[model samples]
Target: MPIDQLVTLLENESIREALMIVYERSDGGTEELEWRDVRDALSSEQWGTLIEQEVLVSAGSGFAIAEPGRVERLLGGDDPSEDAGTDGIESPSWTTADKAAGAFALLLFAGYWNTGIRDIVASVESAIFGPVAGLVPFHLVIVFLAVVTGFYSTVLQSRLLDREKLEQYKQRMTDLQERTAAAKERGDEEALERLQEERMAAAGDQLGMFKLQFRPMVWIMLLTIPVFLWLRWKVRGGHLGTGETGLVVPIAGAVTWQQSLVGPMQTWLVWYFCCSMAARQLIQKVFGLRTGTSS
Candidate 1:
């Protein structure tokens, strides 16, 4: 729909409903106008400068606005979690090798992301001319980046491992918006279809987030390879006393190949336990996640 029609609807539509309409019309499946963004996009004069901006359409005490990045993220743009919610936890549901492959892929991602260190180093290369005082070597750079990545990934995986419930919450919010919009349009039996769309979309996304994020090997458990590397190099080596060079050799070695799962339980479950249990607990604690009722 044109921005003008959106504004006409925005005048009377609830903010959430307006957002849903925008999401529906958008090429991709998401929206960039978070509540905070809307607030920021508007002026402080209460409802004063709204329509004048052409970005937002003020409705009956509520509104909608044009969002710049709606399609990108909805279509799987930047947020890693976008796919993480759908594609799965680093590994597929099927094979043992899946997890291992995921670990390698993730590490590769880390390496690739850090490849720019070369540019960073080359920029400084002309400034440093000694054999040992050389600009950061590519291998050393990769290792350094990997180690940092591993630490962050491990922590992130653990955090998201149990996000199943949180995703549901997002789904519900989305659904509620859609249903209310249908009530407005009263578009016929098809309106019921709209409600169905709301229910399914919300439920599916919540389930997807839950399944992917809560998986043991996908999230915090992702730390395994990184953790193992750290353990092999730093924790068990007792080289902290040796300082910088001590860390250097270990990080350099990271260039070599590496390897697992974190189980839900501490024992018997093996590595799978590492992340599974964390995911379960996360879902339980953050109880308010989406659980859209089927219409």
Candidate 2:
């Protein structure tokens, strides 16, 4: 329907109020509203207009939303949980015991793989530069590790997240917000109220999407924490003594007054942070990872 026609229909406070009531009642099946409930608010003429517009249909003793799904969508899409009530949380009902067993096996394999990688990583470290200047070889290894971790995490996150669907929901919520503001500006109290209700429902959906996005983090962290601990042991050699640079930068090898970027920070923590930040962007691009704030 055209905006003008919709506005004309809704211009009547009674009709607007009736629609809101019907929308609120419109759930699983077709919503049925009796004349007694809305008769005091809406006149026979207004009710007839609504019926003629096909927004409402006679069903035995009451009227129901004609196309409940479409109207609900226009009112702001229904919550996905309305049907299944999962609220974006993963349902274990369909996950068979076999699938659960497979996941446990995968987790065990990851633990074993991480333990075996330490020696291999050390070999890679030794071969790369064959004992370069103070911490330079170690720095190279740190960069390489950071890049690998970045790529792995980004790809895993993308695989776990329904980013396209999340983005679409966000866009729709934003559009609804804009429409709500327009209604408020025009002093359409009924429309504003209905839009606000819709926006709140959309917010719930967005929260659910965000929860799904982080669902993979539990698995990722399980593997990553052990690997990082090993890296920490290698880099710090189980301890950090003063005046020992973890990774020395060749160009500005020493932390001088001129090189304030690092600001006298010479620990593995700082090195890892710098490398991770630098490599994350490149790795995200290579893996086609999405970077954006969830609404």
Q: Pick the candidate with the highest TM-score.
A: 2
| Regions of candidate 2 where Cα sits further than 4 Å from its true position | 1-136, 235-244, 249-266, 286-295
Cα deviation at 50, candidate 1, in Å, is 33
The top-ranked prediction according to lDDT is 2
Candidate RMSDs in Å, in order, are 18.7, 11.6
lDDT of each: 0.39, 0.56
- CA error at residue 3 for candidate 2, angstroms: 14
Residue 127 of model 1 has an lDDT of 41
List model 1 lDDT by residue over 86-193, tens digit each: 232232142465467566547633532354532343334324322322345423433443444444544555543435444445544554565456344433343355
Candidate 1 lDDT at 280 equals 44
Relative to the true structure, candidate 1 reaches a TM of 0.24
